[model samples]
Target chain A: MDVAIIKYNAGNIRSVDHALKRLGVSAEITDDPDRIKAAERVIFPGVGEAVSTMAYLRERELDKLIAGLTQPVLGICLGQQLMCQWSEEGDTSCIGIFDQPVKQFPAHELKVPHMGWNSLDRLSGELFPESLLGSYVYFVHSYYVPECEDSAAVCNYIVPFSAAMQKGNFYATQFHPEKSGGPGQEILSNFLKL
Target chain B: MLAKRIIPCLDIRNGMTVKGINFENVVDVGDPVELGAKYAQEGADELVYLDITATHEGRKLFADLVGRIAEHLNIPFTVGGGINHVSDAGILLSAGADKVSINSSAVRDPDLLDRIAGGFGNQFVVVAIDAQFKDEKWTVFVNGGRIPTDKELFSWAHEAQERGAGEILFTSMNHDGTKDGYACEALKTLSEKLSIPVIASGGAGKEDHFVEVFQEGKADAALAASIFHYNEIPIPELKSYLKQNHINIR
Candidate 1:
């Protein structure tokens, strides 16, 4: 299957690329909209500031192109947040693909940036396999998408938030599947098969 | 509710897993990939690899080992030691590290933290602080606990956060490998002070120690090396105990 990983000014793209190579699938990492639209599957992965990242996507007009794609597009970490309607990080407007808004973790006594590995809970949606219920995945995020109509799984840190979401052809996860071990690979494999 | 985390730390020297007390009296553990996979299967929430070797040759080996482990296991991994440049961060993250931790390098150039956070996102940048108690004050240490910085712990931690560090991995050099328990007092102070998650490392010997760090210290995660390497406390058993103690674990 042809998997296109949208590449803007971000990190973790190479790791995701290597992961797909390990799965015996050749994937392309590009910022070009036409190449992304041509792929059977799309992987939107980012590790950077939300506003600047969104700006980079907008600069190339990949923002609208992404929203318009009919293929199954998967957004990871910051990519997932940008797929939402808006984000508070940079007071930025997003793709509005999902109805939820990405908000920063409450700067209370609890930690603002929830790093490390945590398990998925209260999973829903057909994209996830039965074996994936209650499975642990690696997550590193400061802002999260609150539980909304598209939530596939939820994770809590100070407060609960959507860890994974699936709305129409777009499937996004706040967790890094490429970095997450076994269960993570399973999720990636599922996405590939889809 | 938020699920609690269990992390296994592997100390690598010359491409081999090593464990020691007080960061000395080192003893070889085993292969990193084997141990890492074991922890993953045993229900470890995450794995941290610290390369203790200081030579250029050792770094190449560490990178190779990280790649081997990443290919073998499906879990989140953090890599640290001898990381001073954005290229180093890029190398490790590309090799499958979920996060690249900076210590002495970040202290030398705070802008390095900003550069990394800008390049890799703050979420992937972890600032590891090795603090020692001296003159009734917590002092930050560099060069693998060899050099002490005059800067106070609280201020350094705040600077790290302001520079966009995602989390702070605090290791009390005074309590490391002592097996007495975590430096709860220090951890609690930092945990309460910082807005980012604090991972309490060093001196975890028993399962209850994990509970103590979370309950009393308010640490987001607890990291240990010897206990896990020697099989003194299995990851699954530790998780079970944490669960029984009403702590979240998966």
Candidate 2:
């Protein structure tokens, strides 16, 4: 399958490309809108601040292009946050692909980023199979989307939040599937199959 | 639940895994990618590669090795050793290192932390502090625990956090290489003082030592080298032991 990973001013895009290569798929990392629209699959992966990232996306007109994608589009980490309606990080508005808002994890006894391996609960949608239920996936983020009607999975840190979400052709995960080990590999394979 | 992480640290010299990896049934033991893949298969949560090479060519070799490791392993990994500037960290991160750890360089120039965290987000930076207990006070040491700095342990760690460090990798020089146990008292104090995750390094002797580090130390993660590299304490057995001990483990 011809897969294209939308590249921008984001981090870890190389890691995501390596992950796809590990799964026997050579995905093109491109910023060209035509190639992104022509690919069979599109992956929006990033690791950066949300506000500045949104601004960059808008300046390049990639934000609208991403929201209009009708294929099996997957967003990872910061990519997922930018798909939401708005983000608390710098109080910036997002692409509005998912009817959710991103907010920072409340300051409490727990750590801010919620780093390391954390298990997912309430596995739903096509991105996660039954085998992924209660399986630990790697996570490294301070901001998260609250559990809602579109939540595909939930994870508890200081509070229960959306670990994965799916709506129409768009699917997203706050955790890094490329770095989540075996269970994470399975997730990427599932997305490829979709 | 967020599981406690088990990280196996590998020392890289001239772009090869060093300190004599003694794992049996392994080909090319000196190869970082091969050894790191094996650890990941054994249920290691993450890996740390400390590049001890000093030459410019050796740093380039280490970056190539980082890309090779990223292509082979699925879990996250951090690279450290001679990162003195933001561009140095940038090279490793672009080479597919999930995070770049700064040690002595960060001590010499604390702004290195801010520059890195600002350029690549705080989550991409790990501030590693090596401290030794002396004169009834814990003092920070730099240059691989060779030189002692005037900075205290708690205050320096707090400063790193304020400068936008995502995590703190604390290596108690006194407890390091002792094989008795981790500095639980110091680790608990660090965990309580900082809101970011604390990764305890240095002392890891046995399976029970891992338990003590996680349970009593309240560390977010535990890192060790010899015990894991030599197969003295296998990761699967240690993880199951932690599970039986009612500790949250992956």
Candidate 3:
């Protein structure tokens, strides 16, 4: 499959590239909208602050291009957050793909960033299956998308939030499927099949 | 609820996993990559590879091995020890390292924390502090615990956080290799003082010791080497024990 990873000033796209390569699919990391739009599949993988990432995307005019793509696009971590309408981190506006605003996890007995392996249940969409229910996937973000219509999977930390979201041709995961071992590989494989 | 992490720390010397107690003993427990995969499959939340090599050649080998390991493993793996420049971290990150930890170098240039946080994200930079109790106070040690610094442990941890460390890996030099128990008192105080997650390292002999670290020490994670390496305490059994004890574990 011809896959392109959106390159911007965000978090590790290389890891996503490597993850695909592990599954025998070599993906191109490109900021050029033509390359991304032409690919059969596109991945928007990121790990950066929302405002700066949005600025990078908007400055290069890739934001508009990404919003226009009809191919299956998988967004991971910060990519998922930016796909939302807005984010509380850095108080920045986002691409509004999911029509939900991201907010910081409420202050509770648990710490922020919610780092480490957590269980993902309530599998509800094509990106995941019943096999992944109650499976432990990795998570390391403070901001989360609330339980929305786009939510494909849910994980509880400070509160139950969207672990994975699917809207039209766009599928996103607040958790890093690229780094979640075998289950992670399965999620990526499922996206590719779509 | 977030699960408390159980991390297995592997000490590498001359590209081989060695015993934490003695540097000279190059214990062929197994290749680090394979061992890391084993632990991950058996339910280890994270893995830390501490390359104790001081030579430039060893750093290259470590970086290359990290790439190979990253290809096979799908968990959060931290590459630590002997980070001289910011580019070193970049190289590792490109090679698929989730996070790069620096102790002596971060101590020398405290601003590296902010710089790394700005360049990469704060979650990608881990500040590892080795502390030894001396003169009635815990003092920071650098250069493989060979040189003692005037800086106190508590203040340095606070500074590291302010400088943009996502997490602190605090190792108790006095408790290391002893396997008695973790320095729970110090860990508790450090966790209470800092808002970031604190990973308690150094001494872990039994499963109960891990229980103590999470419950009493209040550590977000606990790291041990020989106990897990030697099979004295397998990760699956340990995790089950922790679960039985009402500790949140994956």
Candidate 4:
């Protein structure tokens, strides 16, 4: 299967590509719309500031291109946040694909960025196979998508927030499956099979 | 309910799992991938791999080891040591690390923390603080506890939080490997002071130590090396004990 990872000016795309390679699947990393659209599956993986990242995607017109893809498009970390309606990081507007707003963690005694391995409270979705239900996945995020119509999985830190979402062909996760171990790889592998 | 965490720390030298006290008397434990898998099955909440010799020839080996562990393990894992830049963080995360722990690098350039947190999101970035009791204050140490800084533990922790650090893995160098217990006072103070979760490392001798760290120190998690490596404490039983003591663990 041809797996295309959307490459913008972000830090972690190579790793995601490497992960796919380890899974014995060849993946192409690109920002080219035609290449992404042509692929059997697409992954938008990134690690950077939301606003600046969106700026880069917008400048390259990959934003519109990503929104238009018909194949299954998976967004990771910042990519997932950017797929939401808006982000409070820099008061930025996002792709509005998930119809949800990304908001910052409440400034309380709890940490702003809820990092480390946290378990998922499965809501309802076939996005995660039976092997992944109630399993712990790695997560590192400060802003989170509030529980909305599309939430497929939820995790609680200081409060509950959407951990994974699926809206038709556009599926996104706040957690980095590329970083998460077995459960993460399973999720990615499932996405690939889909 | 938030599930508690159990993390096993593996010290690696030349890509082989090793253990020692005060960073000396290194002894090979086992293959990192095997050990990691063992921990996962044993109900360990997470696993940590620290490259003791990450300076030169061992760096590539560490990455390779991470790749191997990532392939087999189903639980979360963390990698630390010799991570100096944002790119380095990217390398480890890509290699299958659930989170990247930074100590010396974060101390040298505070902005490095912000840049990493901004790029990777704060959740992937862990600021590990190695502190020692000195002059009636807990002082931050760098370079694997070889260099001491004037930064106070509390202040530096606050700065790390503000800079977007997702969690604070605090290690009391003085209490490390002492089997006495965690630095409860230090942990309690920091845990009460910061909103971010505080992981207490060093000085866990027995299962009771884990309970004490949670009940008294109020640590979000407890990390141990020798006890777990030497089979002194099995994680499943330890967690069972904690649960019996009315401490939350998973």
lDDT of each: 0.85, 0.91, 0.88, 0.83
Q: Which segments of model 1 are wrong by more than 4 Å?
A: A18-24, A32-34, A118-122, A129-133, A156-160, B21-28
Report the Cα lDDT for residue B99, model 3. Answer: 87
Which lDDT tens digits does candidate 3 get at residues B200-219? 99889999999999999999
lDDT of 4 by residue, B86-184 (tens): 888888877767678999889889999998887767767779999999779999999989999978899999999999887899999889979999999
lDDT of 4 by residue, A19-132 (tens): 687688989888777888899999998777888888999999988888888999899988889999899989999988888899999877665567567777765665676556
Ranked by DockQ, the better of candidates 2 and 3 is 2
Complex DockQ per candidate: 0.54, 0.91, 0.68, 0.32
Q: In candidate 1, list every pair of residues with a backbone clash.
A: A181-B74, A181-B75, A182-B74
Interface RMSD of each: 2.6, 0.7, 1.5, 3.9
* Residue A140 accuracy (lDDT) in model 2: 92
Model 2 chain A, poorest ten-residue lDDT window?
A125-134
lDDT by residue (tens digit), candidate 1, A89-119: 9899998899889998876655667766677
Number of clashes recorded per candidate: 3, 0, 1, 7
Best by DockQ: 2
Candidate 2: where are CA atoms >4 Å away? B20-29
Give the CA lDDT, 0 to 100, for residue A40 in model 2.
Answer: 95
Mind giving the per-residue lDDT tens digits that candidate 1 earns over B1-250? Answer: 4566777888899999998864689888789999888888888877899898989999999999988877766667789999889999988977878788899999989899999988877878889999999899999988888898887898999999999898889999888868889999989988888888888998898888999999999988888877888889977788888989999766
Give residue A103's error in model 3 in angstroms.
Answer: 1.5
Candidates' chain A TM-scores: 0.96, 0.98, 0.98, 0.96
